[model samples]
Target: MAILELAIGFFVLAVLAGIFGARGVAGMSMEIARLLIIVFLILAIISLIL
Candidate 1:
């Protein structure tokens, strides 16, 4: 559930970025990718621990 939420958030952000961001789009995309990866890893770790 959390993972799905995070993915949807990432997708929405990507779409917004595509529409509005031109110069900083590359950096924004990379940062979003990194954030999503971190979120996934953290969720995985928590699930495993629980």
Candidate 2:
């Protein structure tokens, strides 16, 4: 799903930012990734139930 892909992309961005020593950016990106993943999971569950 698009949300999952966005989460994965953000995860990769976080990793790269971390490697580059951008702690703030990395943290923000990782937080976004986590949120996206949670949203994706929720959507998937709702879709399944429906």
Candidate 3:
């Protein structure tokens, strides 16, 4: 849940940065968001299986 929220926050930050023309920040945030979401999903799957 916390990871999901962090991913969402990063996604929002990426979008805002993109709007403001901060390409580097936007890219980095987007990458972070993607990684967090992937981690969250993996953890969720593991929890469900175990």
Candidate 4:
């Protein structure tokens, strides 16, 4: 839940940064968001399996 929210926050940041023309920050935020979403999904799947 928290991780999902964090990921969402990062995604929003990326979108806003991109709109503002901050390519580096947008790219970095997007990467971080992707990582966080992957981690969150993995954790969710593990939790369900366990």
lDDT of each: 0.70, 0.98, 1.00, 0.99
Model 1, residue 18: distance off in Å is: 13
Off by over 4 Å in 4: none
Q: In lDDT terms, how accurate is model 2? A: 0.98
* TM-scores for candidates 1 onward, in order: 0.54, 0.97, 0.99, 0.98
* Candidate 3 local lDDT, 1-50, one digit each (tens): 99999999999999999999999999999999999999999999999999
Q: Write the per-residue lDDT of candidate 2 for residues 1-50, one digit (tens) a residue.
A: 99999999999999999999999999999999999999999999999999
Instruction: Identify the runs in model 3 with alpha carbons over 4 angstroms from their true place.
Output: none
What lDDT is reached at residue 27 by model 2?
A: 100
Q: Model 1 over residues 1-50: C-alpha lDDT tens digits?
A: 66657666766676677777663764576577677777888988999999
lDDT of 4 at 48: 98
Q: What is candidate 2's TM-score against the reference? A: 0.97
1 against 3, candidate with superior TM-score: 3
Model 1 residue 22 CA deviation in Å: 5.7
- For model 4, state the Cα shift of residue 31 in Å: 0.3
Candidate closest to the true structure, highest lDDT: 3
* TM-score preference between candidates 3 and 4, better one: 3
lDDT, residue 44, candidate 1 = 88
Q: What is the C-alpha RMSD of each candidate to the true structure, in Å?
A: 3.4, 0.4, 0.2, 0.3
User: 1-50, model 4: which lDDT tens digit per residue?
Assistant: 99999999999999999999999999999999999999999999999999
Residue 12 displacement in candidate 1 (angstroms): 15
